[model samples]
Target: MKSTSRQLALSLAAVTLLSAAPGAQAPASSRTRTHVQTLASDKFEGRLTGSSGEKLAADYLIAELKRMGAKPLPGQADFRMPFAFTAGSKDGGTTLKTMTANGMERTHEPGTAMALSFSDSAEVSGPVVFAGYGLVVPESQNFGYDSYAGLDVKDKVVVVLRYFPEDADQKTRAILARYADLRYKAQAARQRGARGMIVITGPRSPNAGELVPMSFDTAIAGSGVVAVSVKGGAWLIEGNGRSLDEVQKELDSGNPHVAGFAVPGVTATINAKVIRQQQTGHNVVAYLPASGSVSGVSKPWVAVGAHYDHLGRGTTGGSLAGKDEVNQIHHGADDNASGTATVLAIADALARQPRKRHLLIAFWSGEELGLLGSAAFVSTPPVALDQLSAYLNFDMVGRVSDNKLTVQATGTSAMWPKLLEQANVAAGFDLVLQEDPYQPTDVGSFNTASVACLTFFTGAHQEYHKPSDTADKINYEDLDRVGTFAAAIAKRLLDGDQVPQFTKVEQKTETGGRAGLRLFTGTIPDYASDVKGLLLGGVIGGGPAEQAGLAKGDVIVEIAGQSITNIYDYTYALELLKIGQPAKVVYLRGGQKQETTLTPAARK
Candidate 1:
């Protein structure tokens, strides 16, 4: 059944006018209130990725969509889009031991002492071998020997030094693709048949037990090798007189080769016991068909989507400077539930009105885990990609600070600016417009596919990504205005004669930029919140960030040795470090602090 185009257009125009002319505020519909309440309720557990709460939210959305008389996607007969994820352990173990050549056995710290995710217990020890940076790069420096040249690290432990070449800032693509810098070093140590890789931490430092467990980028998360940290100090070997710290001191000062310890009878043991459990989550998609479905006419489709996933229960509280607190629900009311509620209200309005195009209302999962669900949707879309005429996204639209509403990617589509201008004129609401399309939201996925994308957001608040982003903090009246504005935009898109066109930048490399580096990955950055340490909203495919394994929702706490207190700090730090220069990056994931070395690229 198709609706008549002329009638649909007329109806949409009426909605646009009604939404624009506001004499007095109307109370929010029970439907919208209920949705916001339930989705962000404690039962949802912050709508964490790969959790049962997320599934519950999905079920609720599916039920609502079914009630609206919307049909399922081509293949599936339901509204739930399923996906899988693998969340690793927060702490590898409680007990980690390290030894030196002077008969001194020391216990390694948990977060500092990294270990292989999958490794068997072993107790075989051999003489310590020092490999130069544990890196094998013949292209740039032509280091004559391979990483393990003439040196044997089979079954025996490989004592590797930290940090890449102190001068990597002067070259491009100087290291191997997969085996470059510290990641490469760890992988090389594991692949060189070494029982373990002992990484030397920067100088002797006290353990930092106050850090919080936040999400990590994909770069360090996906490395499968196990390793641990070791302090620089002297050690008594089996019948050897030289110390491990003495050997390291000589290497750092000037010596080119290991000039001291080569003992034989020393032995060590490692016992690891880890139990991993599989987790699942679902994406919630609902639709509101055109009001005049019985008539015959062609109408474009508009999708309203937002991810409802948050940091969930982690080792960190809302603030990173506080003590390590666990089992606290990170109620992402503003981070998402706000946007989720807006979608439900729009669905209700569209469901009641005689509209032109079919409206799809979707809530995504795994957004906290690198936009996996949305990426999967774009990869294998339910409807054809071309059929998706426009995408309207709402990430954190509830908090209206200083009455400022930021509409991102207004330039992504030709019709977007005009539509928003009309809305601003009619609604009497001043819309702060920023031309950044690759922002911290799911719209970038649609933008990447060459479809028109627009994101409606209220500027960041203190409660973003924290347990304090509760429903009470939501500005309901402001939300109503935002929702009405979004619906009007959708209506205009459906009724307008001209379709939004993709305005490709001259250089695809500069389209979506992060840290001033040219990155090809299409992921957006969430500048809405600075608490999660400045972070990128998304990672483009095959881009530098992706090449380095940087995933979405991973908080970038530091770049080089600079602390990234906010997005500004992050950008400044990146500016100091030139492109193609490999630098050691320290970030926190799941409460445990880890480091990864990456080479930045020009913005893509």
Candidate 2:
């Protein structure tokens, strides 16, 4: 089963013999180019996930699959698989009110006194305890600090500054960042028996004269305490004749020996509310019945997949271009239209073969949005996951210039490299093999389930994710060769008795596949989110984000004062975050403005 001259000859003979079969119509280079052109053309509108283009493309694939005698999986359905995720936060309204010890009462408007996204929709009122930075760091490196230190905030609303000590040394700032989550801050308050927590940008912070803005992606599912930020809280504190500016200046002097206190004759009340918006998404799958099977043993199905989604007119899908700045149609011809086309070709070719096991050829939607379609399919597989023998994925297979073809997930199975070597003997190409199964493609979804998988790519170029990625740029002959190589491998896996072994990857990777980029924020960015801000699909539990209360769906707009208009900007900003220092991260949680201090760490 390994690479050998005899194996090579046999493999060539088998492919030739298979193609010569009465019903077999080997995938042709002309057909591959036609598929790519048909899928990438403007008539398809770039095949943006959840868009009309995607629907039309799906319809076309379904027709083609039907023509090839494709059927729905074990379960009955058309060629479409569907799933939903947090598209964004709903625009909601909130309110706040205040009553002083002197019987003076004031109620601030919603925009002027913003409600935090994570705040419970409840009310609280009492004497306010001023908590410095509202921070709590464990006994770490002798650098621990607690804003609730020696303070009696129980049953009272606690007023805390938004960040840690202003002038703390780099190490201290970094250490303090671990707990810079707003929800975590509220959690701490609730833990301390406080009814509520209020945040404000003290003189030492980066906010200006405006109400703190809430993010569009809300975080309304944590602790019982309600939280809000008041723009003019200085008047309530100044009632004690202690100027807020003086207190802030003193704290910012690099000596954060700052302390919290009770503001005499000052007390406040809080009220807040929220509304959620919901949306739906879809994925497409088609199945080809087995042609042949082992007589005495159960046979596993082979899954061939590729994402058919792309950034639509620079709207809401992952894009390298600035939001609305580069609004031309992004014709992702090479990104995966190439991969999708190959899947189409393979379906027709596989239909004519003997069914050893089932073949599931899928063209995924919302892949640009974070492999969502693939992830969804994996979550609720049409067939038993254990019955899946192997997954072969093709992405960006259109640009195989110089015969250099990149194959990822070689580590997934010991048989892969040798088999690939054997397959390439007849179709010569420079193969670059990567052992790690982690990649930004649909294959990652199968790999997550411990399924042996492989993803083929030509390589990235300047045109990737750009409007310039048109059908004309695709190297059709190269793409056709890739499809041929992949189809052969798929056929060998399905027809032979040997099953590829699955290897679980254990290499530690930083948040959002940033190990090579070198920085860990513990945030899993939603690659499919087309929002102007960086949308987080997930935050690693117990990581810095969870420690700081950063939750899923939170869209980060700025990091360390740098505007993050896109993922590329976020990447550039990561380089500026000094290790052992806390930097402000401004974000939106369902129309509520919120910020947090995050400490950067070297990627492990």
Best by TM-score: 2
Q: Least accurate stretch of 10 residues (summed lDDT) in model 2?
A: 215-224
Tens-digit lDDT track of model 1 for 268-292: 4343323233455678776766555
Please give the RMSD of candidate 2 to the true structure.
11.3
Looking at model 1, residue 295 earns an lDDT score of 41
Q: How far does residue 290 in candidate 1 sit from its true spot (Å)? A: 4.2
* Alpha-carbon deviation at 204 in model 2, angstroms: 7.4
Q: Model 2 TM-score?
A: 0.73
Backbone clashes in candidate 1 total: 34
> Where is model 1 more than 4 Å wrong at Cα?
1-30, 89-114, 118-157, 161-239, 243-278, 290-299, 314-327, 505-604
Per-model TM-score on C-alpha atoms? 0.64, 0.73
